[model samples]
Target: MIYAYIAVMAITTYLVRALPLTIFRGKITNKYIRSFLKYVPCACLSAMIFPSILFATNHIISGAVGLLVAILFALRNKSLVIVAASSCVAVYVTELLMTLI
Candidate 1:
């Protein structure tokens, strides 16, 4: 039963990924559609990641602090490493302060 479930999942995942490639043979030339598609991945990734970020730390406040720090760094066009490191530090400091209070 577990094997069957795994097989079904694998097939469904493969089809979802493969169907797009087989169907879209030509370049997508519509400007609106192209622009929408360009941001889709980022939107999807954020949707998946944002919730987890909020729950990753001991307290929600720390997670929010980290998110804010990350966003500020990102808006400033900082490097990935800088953004990530700063966010981690912010979370850590927030957690420490929360513990003290």
Candidate 2:
């Protein structure tokens, strides 16, 4: 019974995802649609990042500090690596300070 349920779920998932590509193979010529699709990655990335960053450390203060540092680096148009490292460093330092205090 469990095997049957797993098989059914796998088939349904595959069909749901594969059917879209099979149906929409042609170029999407609509400018608005194309523009929307182009920004999807950024939207998706933000959706994935925000929640985890909000609660990444033992204290909320560390998380907030990390987020602020990350935003500052991003606003300055720093490289992705630099932004990430700065955020990590901020979080670590904040957490360490919280521990000492």
**What TM value does model 1 have?**
0.74
lDDT of each: 0.95, 0.93
lDDT string for model 2 (1-101, tens) is: 99999999999999999998999999999999999999999999999878787787888888989999999999999999999999999999988988889
Report the Cα RMSD per candidate.
Answer: 2.4, 3.1
List TM-scores for all candidates, in order. Answer: 0.74, 0.71
Candidate 1 backbone clash number: 0
Worst 10 residues of 1 by lDDT: 48-57
